[model samples]
Target: MAAGGEPVRLIMSGAVVGQELAAEFGPLPPAMLPVGVQKLYELQLEALGGTRQHLVLPEGYGLTDYDRERLARAGVEVAPIPEGLRLGEAVVYALNSIGAGEGPVHILHGDTLIAEPPLHADDVIVGARRSNEYAWAEIETDASGRITVLVDTRAGEEGREHQPVAAGYFSFSSGVELLRSLTRMRGDFIAGVNHYAAGRPMRALGGGRWLDFGHLQTFFQSRLAVTTARAFNTVRIDGLTARKSSRDEAKIWAEAHWLQEAPPAVQVYCARLLGFGAEAGRSFYETEYEYLPVLSELFVHGALARQPWLRILASCEAFLRTCAQLSGGGSGDAALKALAADKTAARLEAFARETGFDIDAALSLEGRPAPSLRAIAERLVPAYDLQSGAADSVCHGDFCFSNILYDSRVRRIRAIDPRGLVGERPTLYGDVRYDLAKLAHSIVGRYDQIIAGRCRAERRGADFSIAFEPIACQPWLEAALGEMNVRGVRGRSVPVQAVTVSLFLSMIPLHADKPERQMAFIANALRLFLELDSQ
Candidate 1:
């Protein structure tokens, strides 16, 4: 930017994101997933000095009110990228529309993850590679690192001359001069840079934690990278107030302790990832959410149309069906099994507190005879298709009332904080029944009441018991039961028992900071285990 001149930045997010990545998370539009813990779009802004530049995104790519508000919070403007324009033209169009006025315009790919962006006043498009694989734009650079021969092809062979890569990211004095050469550009970032490189050569810089969001494999790889970080960003104790919904008619809240816990790249993907994992893989569980105008809000005000049971059920159905249709079907059984066999009980004990029962004692019951968890798993394994994720199974890894948003007046509901996968792995269709079990836990286990402090628990040595208020969300309970058919779910209601038990274990993280809740959760797990074993 010139002295005393305003700065503008354009991010070309209109280019549809990878289909595989979208399918995993279900109907997620481009630039929605995270690179580390932050959303791709946010990553761009963060990389480009967030809130400093007047930001703009491409139009015609329909955005949700939630998305708009999120961007608007940081001074971003949206503009239309003319139809049938190339990537080059889109940048130019955004520049003209943004009207930053005679200053440098920085352009970035909406989905690219730039970790250590070394921003400078130079014409360059940069990316890195793993042993020269999947180069977006094959670049041959001179000893001085100035790009010499550039072609957007991965064909033929490779050598030191054709180094680094151009990963849909660049800096232009202004895209104005590159427009005429971009008449037919479509989705190609290097094409526009190549056009401008006719006279002024654009260099290729590599290295740093740069990840190309070019495909599904890379996307998941990025997700795992965040997960595997030794110094990963974990949950922090923040007193931040909750945000209101896009409609402004409700509030969205979560445990401040559990919110914003993911690595910087994927942190905004959801409220929080499962800092605690169980017998299921290290898949993301209930991230956290609190919907205001909560059911209690409407109930207290007398504006409730009726109990939101049906709407909640309908919302669950809609969410599951979408996951099923979007899923293709695949299982990381070996990975899943290894992932599920968590040996981190000792670590969790730190977060747990003494209650009616010992969490350690409850945990020791795993693979034991009295609890006979093996038998419960035997019955649930086939029913839930946990191992294979067969063609018909798709799950909402965490399906419960806490993750739901409901409007009593309109009788509408929306589910939030999904696992986004059956077990957070690849699948055309994951275990559909998986969601059924989770939803059932809320209804049968009286999970919502427990969270709301309406349950009682007692423990005597090896035996544990819980007394929950008779469910009041009868409509929702019955409808969800009918949908998942968990009433006769397994002989002797074994599936419900087993699923509820799993939920008991899964919920440890929600109450990680509370000893009483942790013991209650563990006791419930034991109670459910005993119930399943006997019946």
Candidate 2:
């Protein structure tokens, strides 16, 4: 609640660094991405008591319907800043458009978050941080910790090692008073504030933790910090700022240090819990049959890397062996029957037509209708028919590259986030070939490529490769193929490459929200199936 006892929260959404963030990460606006369980904007707003919300967005950053709906659900009314307007103009425009009433307007920068926020009813409160960087406006507070003046740190000035800088957080008792002040506001918000702050009582609350997500380095560091704090409940801080890669390395070092010297109770409880979980998981395999499922290591020894083909093949072999115990390994179950029952054909066609990827562009199925995809899916999916029968087993239903963490330094691969039971199936087990195909989707389908910023790839029939220009992916593809331990197709293709293509089709419905990813999965599945068909 504000000083007037009415609820109002104003959040500035578009950052000047949004384009840079998109280039580094995906196209998600900074407000939308995860910071622990909450989004960056969600964390900021949560600090303020729930109220009528005003979100300021820049026109350059495209707002999707999903983004708009999400913001609405979060109790926000979005005001898009025209492309030509500056940040100051945008803020003012948003404030006016949202009709911020006579109550206090809780204004916060979308790019920064405070571990301990100092916000109150009436007086102006600015979060001050002790920083070595001189890029920000400096805050000089009086003996009583009252902000006397904010120094504008000019560019090319040498940075002081320990200095106080203003972290952007503001609360105004009167929206009318703030609006009057903002009319004369310059691009520099703090400097502009000094004009209005003359003789006004203001407090400089200082704390050790402050994250400014304006830069890519700070953004990732903030993510790492919040995630670790959520997971381990504490972060060992070596220093505040560094360049990007070394900064993450420093955080990893801090994590390693804490792991060594953390409280024994913490470590012991973690161990006991993991032990119990592992025992319970193993019991399922032991009681059901002799096959061991994909096991995750309780500890990760090094940085997470991509799944190694060797570990993937080994896991598949074990899963396949387990399925060999069942009657007719490739026999279709109810789930498989339902999936292969032709409902997805229109969905595939609609996706293809929308994305400009032709499903029947296949040589044999040229100019074929949407049912052509359904026909191919029937071939790839497991069934009782001899030609389409898939060698079945207990499968990791949701296996993907993200769940597979490998440590190249330690030469170890750990599987995390196993799908315990899929689709109300009688048992956790399914098709062995599906497991093999899913792994292939990660390796051959280049699922990790788009995420790694090589967003586009080339596909022709069964052949798929990351089409990263100025960098050939042939060697990577060859190496991935070399790791397959299948009976006849090593060094050329996965023996179940056709089966993998089918699995790719099955992956589309799983990513209902990520339409582009779904489209890519659909296109690749069709291409791979066509390659097998031609052969």
Candidate 3:
């Protein structure tokens, strides 16, 4: 109702099949009309903040038989009309006819849910509206103070003027004259207003957030957008920080108390224990503590040293022969078979038990089944043959980046991680290409870091003869063959390394994890295998 004492009546129209609209009028003449009018009248009196002087005409009513019965019980005045008339149009006609001479009539859509009482008659209220070049549907305004419109340009060719403006909402003056004038417009009432106002200046009221439950995609997108926004806000409110102060402190302490040099007697003792001859033992001991002097001469001075390949093969053969001799093995061929069949598991178990270490657990984590000690010995036999077939020379048992120290000034390579022992036969040997290949592969894989940068042959002074190189890995087949030679074990090339690389590539989806490198490695291995099989 207007504050100046003019009577105000709310005219609700449109298909009212649902009880949503009629249910709002309590204890007053039912908007649908019949018995419940008393209760509806009371509701209207309470809602409008006035008495029963105003007449309520809710026209354009469309309700199911059941709903009609309920409306009749509520004492609503039902308007009689042809069954097929468009409900929206009929409602407009009814409101204009009934409220023509009234002080002012406010027409509201029945489908719009109003959470609060109607505004004062003089104050205009707006809902949501979307605008296109040809037509606009008014919608609720947003807080940004912008009139948003859902513009559809698809019909511009059909003589529909399209413009981008928020649609689905509008407001007009509640003056009796203005109401009569609006009611006189003939065409689709909503479209008439939009068309009439196309070029005129109208006060624009902004819209708020709104949801149209008309489509599934819109529903889902609304939910997702809201959820994402909330999550982002939460993360912003509660940030994260790193925690490694204790570790950093420990590292600092260790560095500060580090020893500059080791005792002279320690070298002699290590050499003797390692079974190296006096001079070789001394060299090994000195090299272990600092390999710069030796590496510098080899890499920088280009010292005439034995080829790395020959050394690798020779060392492998030597290790196998020494094991066979210790076990009272008769011949190479016989030893190989025996070693393969030997109960190495029990030996490895015994060693672990004696040392109080969990070798099985550690190896399992590396994706390698713990092989028996005898199986290990047998694997070494093929390596012995490869060594003997290649050449006899001093082999760096652990030929890897960490084991070979570098002197930047001299640019030499020196073998630091050495296993000194004599072999009874000429061992397989070649250039250092394979070692370099393994190193390259290792660095890329970051496997060394995972293994804690420990020497493959010595962990807590325990002798384990597996070595890894960071960078400079050989071709798959050659590396496999070299490994077989070093282990003194022979078997048909199984494509194990290639398969492993493929598995790794597949397991990691991130491109930065080296998918291409792994793929290339697999391809090369497959090519080599196919060629070998053909031969």
Candidate 4:
């Protein structure tokens, strides 16, 4: 609430200079960029507290209806101001356009977030941090922490050794007073902010745990800090190496083996295995660290045009083809069947036993009748068979978008986090269909988006419905899948969609940590099955 007993309004400025990020991380604005499992806007909303908030965007920004609906659900109103305006001008334009009443209004920069925000209704406050890396305004505070001056560092302000710089958060006592001060300054954001501070007793609040995504270097640094780690593994990253340790010794050992034994065709597309050891009864291995964007982020949140996405898929297809050609083993029909029918059945049973949600019953998906999980798995076995004399290929068993990293500079991708084990045995070879199924699950199934919270599922016993946020990449993904089907594995038809559905069903017990995720997996599995059953 404001000092006047009205709800405090927040105007979040997302119209920062973001050409560098756009060129590297696809075409989305900085606020919409995916960082780890959440977008920057979602993280900002969680950090900045306010009941009513307006996200100020630049003109000509193409926000999809699904994106708008998601933002509205989070209680954020989108406000677009004139393009190419100065930060101060944009903020003023948004405030005026939104008709912010004469009450306390808080301003937060979209590219930054403060972990422990120190905002109060009594006085105006500017959040400041001790950093000199990026172009941030320097703040001068009096003995009582009252801000006396704000120097715009981007305007050639000489350094006096990295003092407290404004970290892009502000609190105002009166909206009308701020408007007058900003109007007098005439589009000079820093000057207008200084003018407002001069009139009011503006104080400096030292920001604690500030995360900046304003610049390229700091963007990757902050993003790496928040990357979610899998429950079974612990990864420690340094300047040159990423060390992965796991209590499950077999998992770690198999991963190391796969990395080391990978042929040149596959090894060229993977991180080099550095070393391995044991400590404190846990197994550990290190890999060369490369700062690259995850493939899932680009596909889910990136606004890149169609051709670029198709190009990436083409590169992936080439890699998969090479995997089949160079690393073929004996025909593993029995292994494939066991993975599809036996493993899925056991996992589904375990899922029901643990969660008390029986998935063996028939479900309705998108108003279409879908059969039970067991029946789906049973029918999916015929699709799991590799054609006669076709050898099993050495595969990155968990070849999903999340496990793949893309280097935009070279237009190349690297695969990480291989499944490593095939039926409790440490081996680099598996049914090529399994790898195809994994990729299918990412694109056609939209599993990565679901993990990133871009999906909704409503479940009541045996009935379930699911919907994912519509993305621009959908048609491109469909084209890629169509192309993949035309170029079948080893000149034999592959049941990628059927095997993909089975993958989702079998992985339910492993993701018990996130019940929502488990349900989402089931819901998605049903959706895919409905499509297959109709066909």
Candidate 5:
């Protein structure tokens, strides 16, 4: 029971998310789609803030153990209902199965997340947003905020042009009343809503930010709205452009300069820089935004089929091979050593100081003996030094899957968000092997899965064990790694595995917000280091 004298049970109707979205985001419902590092349902649970949360899934919809675990952690119970039922019937079936009590029943369409939902109100409240799109249910409210008429605009109706519509959430006084209204209307959701509204004053609650993930365009737009930024920088997406700004002038300026100074071959593979500016002591740069799915998303979600995955890997191999040709003749060796040895050591030390993890101590990782971070760095000094006296080339310093966007329509890739620095210097070129290590870290290292919360790491003192939820593209990943290793860089054999492990160690401090993520990185680094040492 809540403080408002009515027990609130949040019913998230998942069947409405549709098959189109399901195909894009793999097997998950819209509620489970990744919004930055967390799921959409995770954000919704936090925003809605209730103890009794229930999800309604279509009949025979299978959930993985990982999915069940995450839902369990969030205290959400599942109710599977029969398929082919109308939206209203589905909600009623869900309510009957979950036993919605004599309290407030907050029905949220799974595809929508209201930032500040109007809950426990006296009147029946329907969440509203003003939009001209015919996909939504139109709502006409009187001056007193009561809904006079509600229409399902999807029935091929003429356009009202920028009217208030139901934003896929409604709060009823009790489940009993809602069920009666629904039963009377014969399970037509909008008609039931109209019937209920006619009997009682249904107010329009339209005060807060409401995100709709029902359509492809709106889905991407909502995802951008909720994405988390780095500690030092912020990115805002508006219309067809994205602007990244930072109080650290050097970082932002460097990113802009790298995009500008990239050669023709490199520029063809990256986002076009729109412009740069300074506003209120912050430096900023804008770029043309392409609403393409990031490789990380597609990879982790099992969204692309096996052949597409192979083609993407092939495309990436071609891009990196092209980059290797833009050599600066070993000028970046010193920078590479600084990054692989010096900066990595410093960052590991900083991570230790921040988390009290003792990186100097040895570890027993996954039943295998692992060396301390200091020892690993010591051995890697010579390994990274091997890249010296070899050809260096133009680099996308952060060439990981997450930084690359793939457009399936054109079968091309666009790289975004370069590291913009090599050992504290802002430059466009580095040892090409460093870029290879970044890609390896994503594929062989599973860095993006950790970022996407698809892995678990548990640590007891210096002993650690971690496992990523099984991804569907394992064979493709192995093939990609084999291709990369065989290709090497500029026909020179580089210690990519060793450098990839170091890359994981170096990025620990950058993700300090989630300690579990930091620990996952450490565990993954140890695992990779053991494999490298054995080889």
Candidate 6:
């Protein structure tokens, strides 16, 4: 009933359905199936009548042993092919061994699933769907449907309307001739079809349902579809329904999993904040950080209030957790302490090596009496230490105006965009002063220009009070730190005053324009540091 004469039908083995089909149609003469999956092939033999003649390729000689044994048992001839010969070559060899001898041999991929019985031997049947439905091929059938030209322009510019439809089925007139034709071609055998089709007439078969189950997603979907179809008497309706249901479930599951596994807010904030590096693709980590300000603004503006508090908390916790993880050695408290120590000198030393700075000279300047930057930094360090050491808990790394989200109407403070999580170290975790200093930086930094511009436009007058007063920020910082049990420094107007001064001074070199401001900042920082060191 199948092609190639001698009542022989060749089914490529190795894929999911190959073995099953082979066994079901057996007893005529078992042809050795491809060796892809042995169990499935054995199952196919059992399914078939078990009497089919199978032409087996040699073991490791291009065809697998499983197919060869099965075919040999079925009284089919076993042909040994060259080890490296391709699938098309092996198919041609098998056909030649079966007395089909060359000419046009139909080669089919092992994986294609067919729903109907194969066409007659003389007729070349190609699986085709509506052009709009599949869109893979440019098909145009002739009027009589007798002479069909399936053009495969996968390689050339021969822009034919139709492509050689990819159903795992083909029929060749002569096995040896087909094998020789394919052997001489530089391209793969399927590609050789284009040249073979040049003089031969090919026909297309429409009205059959087929599917490709190559990728994991597609494979699962196809398996589910097949299972559902087998269970239901009417496969058409049930298969479609199963596909839709599975796809929907997959999407929901994916979303839920993503939400559950979402990272911390701080990590997100940092990623967005940093954006992408010039050398790499968009840095997801940096993007999250960079976008924190926007997220905070949204929250403060009540855009995110509609979200559940649990969600907000989860995001915040994720950020803190991430920072703790990156702190190195797993000691969150130690990381905070080190950060608060203002070990910028050591960090700068390392940076100097990378940037070709005079590391020796910079270290020499440390503790050495000097004017300009060194003198001011030394003076400011002690003042900073006094204020910083008085805090009840660690504040957000840069809890400034930009990082704070506040509701003016409710007067509620919502801090977002945490840069790092500090551990409960007495020295580093004590104080609202560091936070206050950061707040000062935020106000006095570039935002001042924006506020000025806005004030000029409103004519309501830009007052520092609208943003934050230095005095008002102090209480807020103190209250925040107090809530965490930070003890205020005794007899000090503001806790961590020296630390704040040092912090402000550090910003001078990075921020100030005028020489006077720069000099003033350096002098204050040097004084604070020196005083703190002495203490």
Query: For this target, which candidate reaches the highest TM-score against the unseen true structure?
Result: 4
**Where does model 6 exceed 4 Å of error?**
1-4, 13-58, 61-83, 97-99, 102-106, 130-141, 146-149, 152-164, 183-187, 228-535
lDDT of 5 by residue, 1-535 (tens): 2334654555555464556565455556667666665667777887777577787777666666787887898788888888778889988788888888566677777878888776656444555554435377788878887788787666345547656778877877667777888999999888888887888677877637878876776888777778666777888887689899999888888889889998888887889899999998999999999877788877775444677777777777777877778875556677577657778889988988888877778888976888897788777777675645665677888889888987666777899988778776787777767887888888889898898778889998788899988877865776656666322552113467778888889888988887888889889988888887776
The sequence of per-residue lDDT tens digits that candidate 2 reaches over residues 251-329 is 3333233223323432221111111111221221101110111111101011112344344445444433443344334
Model 3 per-residue lDDT tens digits across residues 1-535: 4433543344343333233212211111123221111112233333344321223233343343543444455444444433334533554455555543534444433222222333443333344433222333433223553333322333243323222233222333433444434455542555444433443223344334432211222222222222211111111111121111122223222211111111232122111121111231121111122312121112211212234433433443343333222222223333222222222234444545544544333221123233322333333334323223322222222343334433333333333333221122222221122232233323323333222222122222222223332222233324444355433323123222222222222222222244333233223222222333344
TM-score, one value per model? 0.47, 0.49, 0.25, 0.91, 0.88, 0.32
Please state every model's RMSD to the true fold in angstroms.
17.8, 14.4, 29.8, 2.9, 3.4, 26.9
lDDT of 2: 0.49
Error of 4 at 210 (Å): 1.4
Off by over 4 Å in 5: 1-13, 16-23, 101-103, 142-145, 155-158, 277-279, 300-303, 331-335, 349-359, 382-389, 485-494, 512-516
lDDT of 6 by residue, 313-413 (tens): 33433333333333222332333234444543444334344445332332212334433333433444443443232214433555554444322223333
Tens-digit lDDT track of model 4 for 1-535: 3565443455455464377777666656568877886778888877766666888887788787767887898888888887778777777788889888778777877777777666555345546554444567788888887889987666344455747777777777778777888889997877887898888888777656777887767787778667668888899887478889989999999999999999987888888899998999899999988777788888788776777777777767776877777545555554566556677888888888898775667777766777787778777777665444556677788888898887666777788888787778788877767777788888888988888878888887677788888887786686666667312552113466777889899998998888888888888998887777667
TM match of model 1 to true structure? 0.47
In model 4, pairs of residues that clash are none
The models' CA-based lDDT, in order, is 0.48, 0.49, 0.30, 0.76, 0.76, 0.37
Worst-scoring 10-residue span by lDDT in model 6: 455-464
| Ranked by TM-score, top first | 4, 5, 2, 1, 6, 3
Candidate 1 vs 4: which has more lDDT: 4
Candidate 1 residue spans exceeding 4 A from truth? 1-6, 22-29, 34-38, 52-60, 82-84, 130-135, 155-162, 179-191, 228-437, 440-482, 487-535
